[model samples]
Target chain A: MRKLPELNAAGNKIPNRQAICETLMEAAGRDRNVVALCSDSRGSASMTPFFEAFPEQSIEVGIAEQNLVGISAGLAKCGKKPYAFSPACFLSTRSYEQAKIDCAYSDTNVKLIGISGGVSYGALGMSHHSAQDIAAMSAIPNMRVYLPSDRHQTRKLIEALLEDEKCAYVRVGRNPVEDIYSEDDCPFEMDRATILADSEEYDAAIIACGEMVRPAVEAAKLLKNDGIRAAVVDMYCVKPIDREAVLTAARRAKLIVTAEEHAPFGGLGSMVSQIAAAECPRRVINLALPDAPVVTGNSREVFETYGLNAAGIAAAVRGAEEFL
Target chain B: MADHDRTDNVMKDHKMTNSELALLSCRLREQTVDVITGAKTGHIGGDMSVMDILVMLYFRHMNISPANMDDPDRDKFVLSKGHSVESYYTVLAEKGFFDFEAYKNSFSRYGSEFIGHPHNTIPGVEMNSGSLGHGLPVCVGMALAGKMDGAPYRVFTVMGDGELAEGSVWEGAMAAGHYHLDNLCAVVDRNGLQISGRTEDVMSHEPLADRFAAFGWHVIECDGHDMDSLDAAFREAEAFRGMPSVVIAHTVKGCGSSVMEDKAAWHHKVPNAEEAAQIRADLEERKEACRHA
Candidate 1:
């Protein structure tokens, strides 16, 4: 097993759910046409501020996920920018047909913000966990999927998507996440991959996305200690993936390993395999959740149990060394 | 006369006689039956039931220009009972939205834009609707937009009696009433039969008119096949203000065909070649009778 790097300090003063609500409310305050459609998840989605700020623009569809999406599509058709907020599990699964037809197929300007993504509702069981959203969203044709790494990225992505008149889904975490960047960092672009770390003579590339990016950065530091340089790439946009960056990494590195907190099918790894098979099909190993329901535990416990931490990712990268 | 004056005079005299309009509706019904039989699949019963309603809207009520389909100010018509898209395509083609020949070969060859339901892939269709409950909300949205923009275009949608089972219809109804969309009119094709059986046997919507009235709409009832009654109801719908209107058109399923009329089995059953020929002949006889009347 490869040695893991020291984890980043926890308890950083990051933005909580209330902060996200306040930011959305501020955006609504600035634009009268900005509307938020929620499916009986206003309090959980932290949309009270938005509801108070713009009562007329806020629509509570009351547990009807299909109607939530259809009405948003209708509103978007009439030239209103609507953000449909719901629990990640139901929004991506129950009303999936609506997402495909009303938003993706119709090309409606509706931003689907799936709150409480992944195992954020850890102890609440698998019903609330949303580990399959990325896999589901990546298969859609015109949908742009964004899983922001932290609050700063989330705010920037929200701002950019507000201006973009296309269908998009943003998978946001429930708990406060560590700030990944300073205020001066450039705004998030849909198609570009952010490179957090790089070495001149890296033997392998450890591509990570979403919440897994922080761990991959730590794992890269551990790989350096073992006399192996690992490059870390943050692939945020999973649908229209940054193929150019992926191909460059595949050509330069001896081995490529992808890490995501999602299923192996139709996730970041599956996306990479499609490109690497046609471009550079050498040894591409995918590190993702297995094909089963995730076990019950807290978020950290679940991540550790499923081998999605820094140690697991570093070990997977080292396992690819046999091919090189 | 000068050329321009002659053209203006021809345009002024472009009105159709009642017999001609009846013949057009008969042609629409025959074409609907023909395409459904040709494809070996379609909703024929509902199509026949709503033929006259569609005829009234397309020929007389709606100010649609087949030449310029995307004209923003044109009156909007939505087939809320989307299972009957065969009727819509027939009427639209007869009204010259596309070549009449195109619909004759519909739903057979690959890549043909004419699918079972109304899709935006077809040029003249406004919304891609096949799901029973989607059309009314979308129509409400369009009507609300018209109200907001102060556009003088009326919005009309036809819902089936069975489609009233969907709760989204009531949601749209409440919204339309709340907004006071007087420029909107919804015509319910009360054919009384759905896919399974009679609507009353399946899920009773007996008090449908009262339901719409309680939801704050000006409710009107008429025999759907009576052109005079349909014309009056439409005229009243247009005159009403500050509230949306609902015209509950009582119609028999499969109206023209005697054996199939009011029969639920013909909801989607395609006719054999002999039956198709007989139905065509019967429609032709009806057309001749109307001309004589």
Candidate 2:
């Protein structure tokens, strides 16, 4: 197993979006068919390294998201693996029809990379936040939805997507996140849950995805310190979810708590709840944002305010203890 | 080469004189009505209006056939005004993309491969386009990819004047002109009518040529129903260089039949048996006239 990079002495972590750029550059370097198209978001999407490294493979589509997806579909139709990148907020809503017909319905090999997913845009408010992206993308027929937890998972997800010619919508946060796995977890598989913390017996299970996984893992440790041995599972593959894993957790643990950086409806929570209710009915606590627009603040502040951090998840576990 | 043999094989027997092309257009119109009436679903007015352009592109000019369908350098034709697919499908069948009888038998049937829209599942169909404003951007992508590969293929898309209301059309137009995609050509079936009413009454898209020209495209105008005029416009568009070209072909809604001509009611309205018989007689009469002329 290769060793994972250490956290920065100051900021404490590296942005996962950066790993996407580096890994894509490496992939494009190896395979000439791999291409990347950006909608006037090369800088924000961390695509500069790819643009500079392989100038021929990079495409700039101006600020038109509709054209971006359309052009990528065209490229895919011609037997090229094109990854279209833009802000998640606009890409999901602005060019949705193009994504649906050109990419998904046509069965084109276009990888739609939604950058700055969730509230990673900080105080930019609802317009820039992509809290509703998962619901829209997962609803599409041929689309596979994935949200990687950290840098390690992001690299693996890109590799997996490029290995096949499937339509996928991969959402990545704009900011750096703490590492959930080291070099030992080098190889990763999608549509499968990664169990971070496990025990023979537990009070409950905290299932999280994307950036929320770090805090869920932290909350598990915090709960252990309080004599509550809770299991932490990272459900990164939002669609084609690991139903068996969720059923196992629901059977073993008396309670199931889903955490995500998205709206409480039609997201990780809704998916897990639906599975748990049908297979093994139990009390499922959804730790997610409200239906309305999120309040304006930095991502960390917004997360802390909404009890999405480690302490809040730990507190939710304690709150659910009574139900167990 | 095998590619040369394929193009020659498809074009040899089907290559028609101007009068023969006109006769074939009338035949295609009759077949389109039959399919739509049989399926009980289609956009009849736009299909008749766009039939000449489809025949001109498929049977006459565009270097495409089922033999070279997968060739990377084969010219691409995208039906941006995809709802008018009755005409597009007829032309494709005439060009030997698929058996015309099979298409006629299965169109709009439940679980049949032939759907109402131009799906890529059909051989020789480039992009799946039914929603307006999607075809041009996709053509732009294909054209740009050709440029990147230095391939000699040209990309063409045909849209309706009513489809101009979509803002994405201009966005794609802006990109095509900005990139100076000379290998790309677009045609607008200027039938002057949409589903609701006249294009101008629904939303004024006048100075349409100026609008496209302002976007850095070389614009051309022609009588859409006139085969010679359309041939000249397409020839001029192909000869031009350094910018994308758009040929705005003026046409009447439901061009061939007396009752349907210039009528907006025929937009997506399938003809009943009586009306379908009249349309068939009208096209056959035109075909007989062309046979002598």
Candidate 3:
């Protein structure tokens, strides 16, 4: 297995949304069939640069998310690769049926890029946070749900989507996140999860997805110095999840910890536990945003308060001793 | 291209008069009514209402047939008012898109792909649409794709009058207008009734032409049951450019038979044995009348 990147001394933080825009712009420039659509969310999605650069390739559908999905499906039917950008809060709900029927059921090649997912809007309140996108989008049969960990993985995911003709929902956080992998360090796979840290034997297994990956990596480092070993797996592909990785982690660790910036039910934790329980039957600890309208704060404060940070995850692993 | 030697090559060199098209629609309606009766269920009322328009688009004007199904530049049509699929299936089979006998035997049967809604898996159909207010947006997408490819394909969809109540319909309308998609054309089956009641009572979509016109479409109103009027309306829509065009086809909910005409109660109810016989007799009577006229 390849060595994990230097998580402690990472480079600058880059917004995953910006990474999507840059990658999509590059793809669209190379092929006019690659098109980007925004539902009045070009600025928030970091797609304004793409829109200005490729005027013809960029489609602005005003503020309607349903039209955004429907038109993208139509464009795909006629051989154009459409990347539909919209806020996750509305894109996963308001256009849920369209995504289910028009894109997935119809089997159109539409890539739905949901921006500001999982409380990325933070103080914007419950209305803007898309805590249920994973569950909602994951429920569709032909629909593949993904929440990439950082800018590097986000680029790889978008570029991968442009090559295939299938329906997908991709969620990215709003703010810049600490780099988990350098420009050349990120070795990518389409649906399989990538392991950041794996040990022959460990006291606890830490599994994380999307933005929660960085914190899990940090938590692993914190445990390493304390003579506690951990296996950290980034299960980025939430649907068609890496069951092998989950079972492997179950075999290596005394207990399993799954972290995510989503609600407890129907998220990464739920999927991990189901996989682990069927084969290994290990104790699974889910560290996630509680089921409630979270109080107002920035994303960092929310993560800290909800115990979704490095310290919180490390503490959860150590606290597993009470069960053992 | 062996399919090019189809028996129903009526559109190749024959320019059918309005009455001849009407007679043909009545003859096809006989088969449609039989299928609905055999299937024991279908949206028969709307099927009757939109038969004339379907007949004209398939037989006289549109550049589509079994031969050009593989042609990317061929004209595309979507049945947005997909509940009226019985009429659509009849027309498609008549045009040799598929075997009418095969479709008739297994339509809406157990494990049949030929269900009440339009399924694209069946050859000659474009999008799958039983859901209200989805087909127009897809048509807009196809039209935009044609423009981008510089293909000569014309994209068309038929939406029900009652389907206008869906908010997504307006969203699609707004986008179609904004794009100024002249290659895109939409026809509203302006039948007076829906499942619940009259469209005016269930939802006020009155001034239908004005509604589409306000959405940046060049609106054309026509007699839905008259092939000549529908043909003329389509030509006018095709002639206009710089913005999408819409045809508001005025029609009765149940058109062919006196027992079903203008009645919302017949929206989806299967005709009884007596009613089915009466409807078939009425369609045959109309066909005989047309043959003499």
How do all models score by TM-score? Answer: 0.85, 0.95, 0.95
Is model 3 an incorrect, acceptable, medium or high docking prediction? medium
Per-residue lDDT tens digits for candidate 3, residues A51-115, read: 99998888889999888888898899888899999999999999998998899888999999999
How does residue A94 of candidate 2 score in lDDT?
96
Off by over 4 Å in 2: A1-13, B1-14
lDDT for A120 in candidate 3 is 88
Model 1: which docking level applies?
Answer: acceptable
Error of 3 at B265 (Å): 1.1
lDDT score at residue A150, model 1, on the 0-100 scale: 66
Instruction: Rank all candidate structures by their DockQ, best first, as comma-separated numbers.
Output: 2, 3, 1
Q: What TM-score does chain B get in every candidate?
A: 0.93, 0.95, 0.94
Over 4 Å off, model 3: A8-11, A322-324, B1-16
The worst-scoring run of ten residues by lDDT in candidate 3 chain B lies at B1-10
lDDT of predicted model 2: 0.87
Model 2 docking grade: medium
Candidate 3 lDDT for residue B204: 93
Interface RMSD of each: 2.7, 1.0, 1.0
Looking at model 1, the pairs that clash are: none
